[model samples]
Target: MESQESHRIVVTLAQKARDGADAQQLADFIVSSWQTIEASLSPIIGQRSVATLYKRSFYLASREHPWLMDMHEGMQTTVNLAALKAALLERTSAEIAAGAGAALQMFYEALTNLIGASLTERLMRSVWADLFPVPTQENSA
Candidate 1:
């Protein structure tokens, strides 16, 4: 269901991750991160060129977005990732001054699309999971 709350949900998950949350929360963050990407870019880039746009956006976004930077480092890029990132990442002075957060969010979504969510989910489990300890009764105590 689309949101009807009349207010957008900003990335609280990033701050949560920074503060050290549980694996479930991290998983939520991961899913939300992809959602941020899709929601931001899918309309503008469209389906036909989405993959290309994702690559371009991921590369560009990773440069500025801290949360995305982690995912970007682990990504296995091809020549296409390089060329596309370069070509499409040239934002105007006004666009940059306005802030690159929106662009980075779209690109991060593109990275997930480029890499496939399954692989990214696996990575989250294997890599990012350690950053946040899974909550247990013991930990809660």
Candidate 2:
């Protein structure tokens, strides 16, 4: 199903963000990715809706990784990127990957449910073009 594909995209993006990242770099990448996603989605869904989805996703992810709640405490109309980045810096790579990936997957599922999978895919693909790279053709000798 398209929703499944959308989830894959979210997972792939998270993996890409985590790849080759040190703790500081990983936190920067995670926070930057969220900011990019928020910028892309907010106009279409409204900032408040995006914020709600973010909060919901973070809350759901925090059930599995309670440290995530620290980032949620001071959030308002949007995620506190600084808080999230700080929290991420304190986590191991595996925890960062799992928690960030889970939150993103939840957000994608919720977004797809709200906007339909087709639009969500289009929007996300545009926002994260690097994740769905076009393969280059190879010439045989």
The lDDT for every candidate, in the order shown, is 0.39, 0.72
Deviation in Å, model 2, residue 54 alpha carbon: 0.5
Q: After superposition, how far is residue 84 of candidate 2 from its true place, in Å?
A: 0.5
Local accuracy of candidate 2 as per-residue lDDT tens digits, 26-97 = 667678778988888888888888888898888877998898876556567876777788788888876787
Q: How good is model 2 by TM-score?
A: 0.78
Q: Among these predicted structures, which one has the highest TM-score?
A: 2
Identify the runs in model 1 with alpha carbons over 4 angstroms from their true place. Answer: 1-11, 32-45, 62-141
**TM-score of every candidate relative to the true structure:** 0.30, 0.78
